[model samples]
Target: MSEVLEGVEKAEAEAVQIREKAQSQVEEIQRDAERKARGIEQIVRTQLTKEIEALQKSVESKAKNKSQRILLKADEEAVSLEEQGTKNIKKTVDIIIKGVYAFGGGGK
Candidate 1:
């Protein structure tokens, strides 16, 4: 009966040690998972920031290009109008000269 009691006590002590070790492992695993989750979140945030910046740059470049094209077209139209005005002025001068010389029966 004394031997039986010693065997039961030893088994209970071994069970207690096993339970403590398992608890420690569980805590370590939980801490590691939390750390990995934080690292992934940071990486995602950084990547998203870069992508957003790139998109903004792309949009700005397109807008600038469109503005330049509009300005160039306006300049071309101004030049065309100036050329037409110059031609009209020459025609008017010729008409005035003919009118001034009409008394002498001279015309161009």
Candidate 2:
């Protein structure tokens, strides 16, 4: 009877030890998972920041290039208008001179 009691006690002790070991393993796994999650969060944040910065730079570059093109086009249009004005003025002066010569008396 005493031997049977001793076997029961030993079995109970082993069960308690197994429960404690399982609990410790569970805690360790939880801690490891938390650490990994933090690492992944940081990596994602860094990548997002980089992507945003790159996009901002690209937009700025495009805006600058567009502005430059607009300025150049405006300059070209102004020059074309100036040349056209000069040509019109010259034509007006030539017509006036010929009319005055005709009025001053007929040329032989």
Candidate 3:
């Protein structure tokens, strides 16, 4: 009966030790999982930042190109209007001179 009691005590101690070890292992696993999750989060954030920057540059480049095309077209239109105005100058002047002579009751 004394030996049987000793055996039971030893078994209980061993079971306690096993439980402690398992608890320690679980804590370690949780810590490792948290560390890995932080690392993955950092990587995803970095990738997203890079993609956003690239997109901003692409949009800026496209806007610049569009603005350049519009400016060039406006400049061309201004030049065309200037040329037309120059071409009409002689006729405009002649008409003005004829009107002045008629208003003065003089021969042209």
Candidate 4:
């Protein structure tokens, strides 16, 4: 029965080799999947940072525009008030002059 023993030994050796090859393939696949996952994570983080920066810039621009408009409106109101005050002063001066002329007042 020497031939029977040799056949059994060869079959066991072939089985061991097949098992080792399958384990190696499984390890390689796991490593590749982990690498791809890390790459995706980095890309997402970069994109989010850019979007946040853009949003902040937009908010600042709008705020500055609103502040400028408010300042312009205040300036316009101040100018209008100054013009009215000058007109009132002129009217008062004219009235005083007319009263003095009506009376006989001559200062030399």
Q: What's the CA error at residue 108 for candidate 3, in Å?
A: 11
| Clashing pairs in model 2, backbone N/Cα/C closer than 3 A | none
**Tens-digit per-residue lDDT, 1-108, candidate 4:** 999999999999999999999999999999999999989988998999899999999999999999999999999999998998787988878778878886877521
lDDT, each prediction: 0.95, 0.93, 0.96, 0.90
Superposed on all Cα atoms, model 2 deviates from the true structure by an RMSD in Å of 7.3
The predictions' CA RMSDs to the true structure, in order, are 7.4, 7.3, 4.4, 7.6
- Give the Cα error of residue 2 in candidate 3, in Å: 3.8
- Every model's TM-score: 0.60, 0.59, 0.61, 0.56
RMSD of 3: 4.4
Question: Candidates ranked by TM-score, best first?
Answer: 3, 1, 2, 4
Better candidate number, 1 or 4, judged by lDDT: 1
Highest TM-score against the true fold, candidate: 3
Steric collisions counted per model: 0, 0, 0, 0
**Candidate 4, pairs of clashing residues:** none
- TM for candidate 2 is 0.59
Q: What is the lDDT of residue 16 in candidate 2?
A: 100
lDDT of 2 by residue, 36-89 (tens): 998998899999999999999999999999999999999999999999989798
TM-score of 1: 0.60
* Candidate 1 root-mean-square deviation in Å: 7.4
The model with the greater lDDT, 2 or 4, is 2
